[model samples]
Target: MLQYIIKRLLVMVPTLLGVLTITFLVTQFIPGGPVDHMLAQLDGHGARSGADTGESATGGWSYSGRQGIDAAQIEQITALYGFDKPPLTRYWEMLKNYVRFELGDSYYHHQSVASLIQEKLGVTVSLGVWIFFLTYLVSVPLGVAKAVRAGSRFDTVTTLIVLVGYATPGFVLGILLIVLFGGGSFWDIFPLRGLTSDHWHELGWGGKILDYLWHITLPVVASVVSLFAMKTLLTKNMFLEEISRQYVLTARAKGLSERQVLWKHVFRNTLLPLITGFPATFIGAFFTGSLLIETLFSLDGLGLLSYEAINNRDYPVVLGTLYLFTLIGLLIKLLSDIAYLFVDPRIKFTAQES
Candidate 1:
């Protein structure tokens, strides 16, 4: 197992490089740079404020209007941001910095990307923990029961509910929930946006905890509502398939109870296929932070951060988030492979190149 882990870790080098290269190529090919995004934002703000003054909002000297940006202004912006160099050169510099864990400062935030991530990491981690718990806790037993009671009323009802949950969009669900329970004419039970109230700092420990959970309740439900169906159905089908296998029949024929045959013989093997996809669950929890939900809830998580970064062309934040996410995905893949050895001891790993 250790040897397999070591080999997989080594393999991650090239895989990571491939990911980085692709990311760099895509970002480079994008039409506008950070400066362009910044100018557009400023233009929109000026129009909204009805400030016809030739000066920028920041009181910085004016630029040529929507007609065109001047060469000197473009040159200054490029030089400041190191965009004057070739893409390959910029990539090399970024790679060097990333290797040292030195994610550069955000263009607008005036803080290092690492610091921003640190601030937001706890919220995402908490969200992930809840999501992971709910996903497995509810899905596993429900799935097994569905499989065991196949063709029964319970199975039919659950299947219909799962299908409906799967079909509904998460954002749609979130909106409905907010309208119904977040305040609507019904009794309000949760905060509309944010992880805490404005006076959170003044609250006692219990109040803080309660407030935090109250704010997160809707987002957590929204995050996992759509996820439950697929996992439950997958687990159910895997178990159903295993129940039909010869090994399970042999165990049953040997006079073992249905429970033992299912749990000891069938369920264990059923989990192998499910376990193979375990990393996807972790990946979804860790990196894919349900951008729409986060944005709608005004939560400060990686999803919203990435969304804002991309819109503003905050390259440091975007690249930092990308690198971190890709690294996480690779690590989870390695962990998933390691988990296999424990799940199925019969599985062996050889050091052969293949």
Candidate 2:
């Protein structure tokens, strides 16, 4: 097992390099860049700076004059970031920095990408955890029941509801929730923005906990509802398949109770397929939490930070986030592979076979 883990860890190095290379190439293809973005920001303000150099007050310098200023600024930025060097050299430098966990500063935010991520990580992770727990907890049991009572009224009704929930986009659901329960038109039962109230620090620990949960209710619901449908269906199908197998019948024939057959035999194996999909599930959980729900509810999470960075052309933040996510994805996949051995006795990771 240790040898297998070591092998997988070794493989992740090239996988990460490939991901970084592709990301770099894609960023290069995007029109304009941080330089253009910076110039736009300084359009009206550069005039004041120019006055110190005996330039005009309006700083609406002639095209040639503006070109000269832009040239100088670009040179400074390029030298600072080593952009004038060969692409391969820069890529190598980036790899070195990544190895050292030194994500550079954001061009727009004026802070280290690492610091920005640290600030936002907790909010996104908290939301993801709630959604993930509720999704599996509620879905698995409902799925087992649905399969046990397949074709019954309960199963049929739940299937329909699950389908509806699965089909609805999270953003649409978030809007409906806000409008219905966030004071847009109906009862104002939940807070519409942020993960905490402004006076959160003033409250006692219990009060702070309650306030946090209160603020997260709608966002969590919106996220969980979108996730619940597919997982429930998958679990129900897995259980159904297990229950019908010959082994289940043999267990029953051996005088095992229905409950024992289902719990000890069927359910234990049913989890294998689910366990195999954990890597994708983990990646999905992190990405899905922030994009629509966080933005809609005004939660300051990683998704919002990525969105802002992309719009502002903050390459450092964008690339740093992608790099972190890729590393996590690789690790999750590795963990899932290791889990297979424990989840099923038949699976093996021997040096000879693996």
Candidate 3:
């Protein structure tokens, strides 16, 4: 076990370097700097003014300057961030700084990246937790039902629902839900947003929760449907496969009841595959949430944070967040491999024998 752990840890070095390289290259492809994202739209407006009234008409303020990133500003930013240095030197510096957990500043927001992360982490964490718990609460029972009823009307209906949930894009789903639920035209159940009211702090604790729930109701429903559908389908397929195994047949032939055959013999083994997929699902959900569900719902999570960072060319925060999320995901996958031994007796038996 110790050797296995050491081996995994050793593998992380190259993985981290690879992550850094990929992030750096990908970010370079996006057009503009932080200044550009803010000012690019203003170029045409400024150009019209320049055409009507010459540059000298506005105290020599050249309105018809470059339409994209300010080259001078970009150069300064590049030099400041050591983009002007040798790539190898910068890479080493990045590796060293990250080792000390110094992720640097948010150039866009003019704040420490760490502090910015601390500020917005609560909402994303809270939403992720609630959605995960709700998903499991609903999915487990539904998965079991689908497994038991394999090809019946119940399974067919559920399979179709899951497929649709998986197919639907998060932004489309989010907008549709807000229109249906938060617009007050349909059920008239909740607010359009998914956070506490503006005066949320002034309310009593119970009142606060109530109001928060009201706002989050639509977002939560959207999140749960997308999340639960995938988990339920995976668990159902695993359970179905397990139910037909020779051991399950033997248990039934031994006069074991349907419940006993399922619970004691089938469910346990079925959980092995599910357990293997668990870490990837959890980690992928964390990163993709920034791009999808969180973005649409206006949740101030790491996902939204990354989006803002990219748009504003806040390289430090963007790179820092990317590395953190990637590191977490890679580690989770590694651990999942190890967890399989505990989840399956055959794996444990092989390890012990070795």
Candidate 4:
């Protein structure tokens, strides 16, 4: 197991490098980089100032216009943003900085990418935890019940409901939820936006908790409603498959109660596939799946931050977040394999298996 873990960790080095390299290359080739964005802003400002002064305004930095910005000024600005450096040299510098865990500063936020992430991490983590726990807590037992009662009215109704939910997009559900519950031409039960009320700091501890829960409820529901169909159906299908297996029949023939045969024999096997998937789902709780839900609720999370960074051409934040996400994904995959050993001891990890 230790050898397997070490090998996996080593493999992650190249994987991370490859992802980073591709991301860096894309950022380089993309139009409207930091340099061009800054220059465009300068040009707009120059155009306005020149027009006000009754001077002839060339589109970009002018040589002898009322706007003081010139070629030298442009060079200084470019150098300041490190656009003066060759792409390969910048890429090498990025690799070195990343090695020391320095994610660098955001282009516009005036803060380190690490600090920005730290600030936003809590919200995403909170949403993810709520979503992940609620999904399993509700889906697993519901699935088991459905499997046990297959072909019944209850199962048929639930199947239809889940299918409808699965067919609907999460953002669409978020909008519907906002309209119905979030003070939009309806009952107005939940707050329209934000993860907490404005007076959250003034509230008592219990009040604070309740307020937080209240604000999060709509967003969490919107995020997880679509997820339920997949998880619940998967659970139900796995359970149904195991129930039909010969071990379940043999357990029943051996005078075991139906409940005992299902829980003791079938439940363990059903859980293996689910457990195998736990790492991805569990890790995903930290890196949220839906930026739209966050946007709908005005929640400042990693998802929203990444979206904004991408749109604004904030390379540091974009690449920094990508690197961290990839690293976490690699580590979680390793952890998943380790979990399998504990979940089912019959599973073995050998060097030869690689």
**Each model's C-alpha lDDT?**
0.81, 0.83, 0.72, 0.84
Q: Give the CA lDDT, 0 to 100, for residue 36 in model 4.
A: 67
lDDT at 68, model 2:
36
| Local accuracy of candidate 1 as per-residue lDDT tens digits, 1-354 | 777778888988788788778878887777666766555555553243325645544322333444455677767876777789988899999999989989899986889999999988877887788887888889988999999999999999999998898898878888888887888767688887788899999999999999899899998888887788988999999999988889887887899999899888888887887777778988786667468877778788888778777766788898898888888888887778777778788887874576
Work out the TM-score per prediction: 0.87, 0.90, 0.81, 0.90
Candidate 3, residues 21-119, lDDT tens digits: the string is 888767655555443433433455333444555643321223334547677866675676556777678667877889988888777677888888888
Flag clash pairs in model 1. none
Screening candidate 4 with a backbone cut-off below 3 angstroms (N, C-alpha, C), the clashing residue pairs are: none
Clashes of 1: 0
**What is the Cα-based lDDT of residue 330 in candidate 3?**
75
Lowest lDDT 10-mer window, candidate 4? Answer: 57-66
From the highest lDDT down, the ranking of the candidates is: 4, 2, 1, 3
Question: Model 2 scores what on Cα lDDT?
Answer: 0.83
Off by over 4 Å in 4: 45-69, 283-288, 351-354
Error of 3 at 268 (Å): 0.8
Task: List model 4 lDDT by residue over 1-354, tens digit each.
Answer: 788788888999999999999999999887767766666566664346556646444222222332555889788877987889999999999999999999999987889999999999988888888988998999899999999999999999999999999899888998998889888778799996688999999999999999999998998888888878878988999999999999888999999998899888888888888777776687656675668878788888899899878765789999999999999888877887887877688887874554
